[model samples]
Target chain A: MDLSPIWLTLKLAAITTSLLFIVGLPIAWWLSKGRSFFKTIVEAIITMPLVLPPSVLGFYLLLAFSPQHGLGKLLQDTFDTQFVFSFKGLVLASFIYSMPFMTGPIKSALQQLPVSLTQASYALGKTQWQTFKSVLVPNIKPSLLTAIVLTFAHTLGEFGVVLMIGGNIPGVTRVASIAVYDSVERMDYAAANTYSLILFSITFVMVISVFVFNKYQAKSPLE
Target chain B: MIDLSIEKRLKAYRGQQILKISHQFTTGSITKIYGPSGAGKTTLLKTIAGLVYPEKGKIVVDSQTWLDTDNNINLPPQKRMPGFVFQDYALFPNMSVLAHLQYATNDMEWIKRLLLLGKLDTLTDHKPIHLSGGQQQRLAVLRALAIKPKLILMDEPFSALDPDMKTELIAELKLLFKELAATVLIVSHNPQELEGLTDGDLYIP
Candidate 1:
């Protein structure tokens, strides 16, 4: 069994999750707290990936990453790095696909928190960043955990977008989901079953551990 | 002296009305704000704290203009840093009793003294979930005092305490407020409860 696909999938999930956290936290915070007129439009755009078909999103990404025009042309001319059919391309696609999974929970978590907590922090002379870091983030641990797990798991199982943009290049973009598809197409049921079992077990353990940890935290006096 | 003249349009189920207030509060004095429900008492406190903005207003604190609509200047809450005790006792659930005070100041002696004042010394490590209603209220008061703010605004701060506890805490707080030379505005539906402690009164209709 070539475990390279598993390693690539893990790497993709890891990088995508980290990038999502960096990019998604500010978006989630703004969506949760801001009352601007443009909020609805931005929210609708971010949530598009959740409802749109993966192939639709992938097609647009493919066009955007094409070296002939727009962002792809700029990247090719300046950075000289091709985004399509590469690990970087796969990462970008996975991030788009998994954005809602990361941002939704975080936004709801921030909204559900008592407004008075932030007010209190401000009254105590703490800045907005201080209040967010010391008060809001600590209290919303459960939601943060849920967002991370869901984004990681969702990215791990992604297929259509990865298939369209990644093109199944082994050792570079051949993630576990693509590997399983390849095995089945070749009538290699044993290899497909092996990949499927490994994916299922890993996801199940991750989800179960999160639940167990949450329950334990709930039982603790501090929570 | 703290001077404020403000107008805010408030919409309630009854109708829309203008909350127009103009007043001067002396430094180091305790003033009671008495009003019926929905008369904008809490809103007034929030406005002074810079948590809410008024349609038209000027708030001058100690010769400093905190808010000046004509000048288009409105300081943020952090810049104002007024100590406020909410009616609901907005203690952070994730933070322990001691952590709440420590977050506002680095003075260990002040923190210890505040814990003693609030009678929360023994429960320093306890979170808000573990504390009783009165204990939580006391913690809120202590947290507000942690900054030794020049102005303190309290909304129904003693509603959760028993009569005896309220009396005792108010006595201690009166001395502490004087020591800090902090102007205090306390909102209450029952003004008699604060008769002796309040030096002046403002009625909102």
Candidate 2:
């Protein structure tokens, strides 16, 4: 089995996880603080990808980014780029697919915070961003870390969205899951075993590490 | 100088009617609002500080109108410079007591003096959630004092303490408030704690 697909999956998860932190943190903050009747509706929309079938999302994305479409045309005209059937397209799909995994922990964590914390920061003459950085975010470090780890892990296991839009191109769009599927389809059990075993061990280690490390940290006096 | 007459209805569970009352909190003086629980005491403080908006009323602080119904002016909470402390002692849990003091001002000597005055020297690196109830209350008072605002609003400031702790904090707060001469509005439901702790009158529900 080619390890390139495994490497690409890791790269995609890392980049998407990093970018989602920047986008999702403020949104989670706003939802945590702002009051509105439409809060549920807005929240539903962000987490829509969680319930929406990945095939449907991939179908829509393929249409929107097919180079002949409007968004594709605009991107091509402006940046001389095409997105359909590419690694970037897979990454974008995974980002959308895994957004709720990031937002869920963050929103719940932030919602549990006391208003007095923000009030104290405001009373101390700190700006909203300053307060978020110095007070709110730091206090919610465990949640933020959860968001990162969950999003990355979920993105790593992504299959349907990557398969539909990625077209299973070798090394470029052939992520580990897709490669496993390809090996299975071609009756190559050995290759499939190699890729599947690695994916399983990596995922197992990640999840176990999260639980073990959290337990260790909890037991340590430094925590 | 802060002048505010706030009124807002907060419908709590079991039909308890909590309202921000229309009463003048005198400017440039320590005017206490003494009320029982669910009497809208905390709401009044929040409304005066612009943390909560009154459905209809006005708040004039230092000659600058913060919230007025007829004039249609309601400033946000951040723009209003009021040092407020809640019942739970609203110190940032992520910050040390020293950082909390530093967030308010940068005068190290003044901070050290304030720390010594409040006897918070040993608790400098402690977070709010980790501190004892009395220590947290003292920290809250010091945090407000550090801001040096024109006015301060405290909701049941000394409620979470033993008698001795309460007496000590009240004494320290009185000295500091008298020294700075900053206007203060403290809510108190504890009548016994109010007798010697407050130098001002009460607004009972």
Note the DockQ of each predicted structure: 0.87, 0.67
The numbered model that scores best in TM-score is: 1
Candidate 1 fraction of reference contacts recovered = 0.88
Native-to-model Cα distance after best TM-score fit, residue B5 in candidate 1, in Å: 1.3
Candidate 1, which CAPRI tier?
A: high
Flag regions of model 2 displaced more than 4 Å: A37-39, A216-223, B14-20
* Candidate 1 lDDT for residue A215: 79
lDDT (10s digit) by residue, model 2, range B9-89:
777767756475555555557776876667778888888777777778987776889899888898876787687887888
lDDT tens digits by residue: candidate 1, B50-120:
99899999999999999999999999999999999998888888899989998999999999999999899
Give the i-RMS of model 1 in Å: 0.7
- TM-score against native, each model: 0.96, 0.92
Candidate 1 residue pairs that clash: none
Worst 10 residues of 2 chain A by lDDT: A214-223
Off by over 4 Å in 1: A216-223
Chain A only: give the TM-score of model 1: 0.95
Give Cα-based local distance difference scores for all models. 0.92, 0.80
